[model samples]
Target: MKGYLKAHTHFFLPSEQMAEYLDLPEKTSYSALPPAGDSNQVLPLPDSALTLFYVGGIGAHYKLNAFIDAARSIPQIRVNLVTRKKQWDEAIASYPTFQSPQIHPYHLNANELDDLYAQSHIGVLAVEPSDYRRFAVPLKLFEYLSRGRPILVTEGTEAARIVSSFNAGWVVPYTAEAIAATLRRLQGNRAEVQAKAANAVSAAKVNTWADRARTVADTLTGKSK
Candidate 1:
């Protein structure tokens, strides 16, 4: 397979073992889109309530229930979840934490989701720890960075590593306690939050879809070493 294929492309690495086994020429890329908002836009430190935004599928693997529970415990923190009605219903039924007033669930279109990202203070991605998650980078992570939102991602995922490397957000255990504690810390340190948000914007500049495309093109064309 390696001999026949010119190159092996991946949205993100599959796994260390798989990469070693394939031993093929590899080009790694991210499924990032151009930022919806202005990358130069400076987000002021939150003086009021800190809002956490999440926009995507509400599958069980996302571990959104933990976020909801954390939000329920933190009255000062606001959570906005944009997803389908069916998923929302299931989540609310399964996790009573969704009943908390701090948790605001909405079904929105692309434009609305973008608007929500602009309004929110932080982005949350609490994926469950799994083999698939270890290497996969969720598209929402890039979108959050592009929109200049500091992220709160679960530890041990590719997204967490990227966020940490870029200093764009907090990476912690996938638990309600950890989420709530991080939110409290961020709420207390507005300056840190602002710094992380700024870092996220900077990361977006390099990780945008156009930049990633050019990198892939360069690799294929033998223009990149």
Candidate 2:
């Protein structure tokens, strides 16, 4: 049987590596998000909004604290961060900007999350490198990609490869200073950032879950087995 996990390739094992273990003859690449909003219609973006989303664990390894610190440097841009439960209250206490209405953390539904994705400019991935993450990719990365927003990847290991391959976003050092600098750059050049968003959306069209389904079928149907 094949283990197919969509939208987790940012930090996971390369398809070639996984195929080796499964003794499978083929590998499939898929996105976690559905797809870009109908390509026929060009999605308009917020003029002065920069939304950064983080929707996962509350572990110490994920440096959400640092991402908030960096986000504070950009005044013109608004930061909307989403985390699990109430862990952010303490984290927010340390940063005065979180007290401001522009920078927020809250719970959202499926449609609400999609609305956020549609309106967001960047997605902040704050997970650090560990054994589990090294072999596993976060679904959020693919979700962010599906929306065609630039990614601010916090992990400095395998995830970097995907960013580099797609030229999706700026790679910051695993520190507050680097993250701050990258966010500033993104803020200064919103046009360039939007272009990266378009590029990401374009690339995603050719790489999708439907393609993965076909490959999975071929393997299980005894065509590739």
> In candidate 2, what are the lDDT values of residues 1-225, reduced to their tens digit?
233335323212343333344443334433222222223322446665566666665546565656666666667667776666566765555554556644666766545676666667776675555554444556666666666766777554445556667887666666768887877776677788888877667655554666555655675455754
Query: Using alpha carbons, what is the TM-score of model 1?
Result: 0.83
Encode model 1's per-residue lDDT on 15-53: one tens digit a residue.
Answer: 343353345455533232222233444454445688888
Query: Over 4 Å off in model 1, which ranges?
Result: 1-47
**Local lDDT at 36 for model 2:** 26
Scanning candidate 1 in windows of ten residues, the lowest lDDT window is 29-38
Q: What count of clashes does model 1 give?
A: 0
- Residue clash pairs of candidate 2: 8-137
For model 2, the stretches where C-alpha displacement exceeds 4 angstroms are 1-43, 90-102, 220-225
Models 1 onward score TM values of: 0.83, 0.72
Which TM-score value belongs to model 2? 0.72
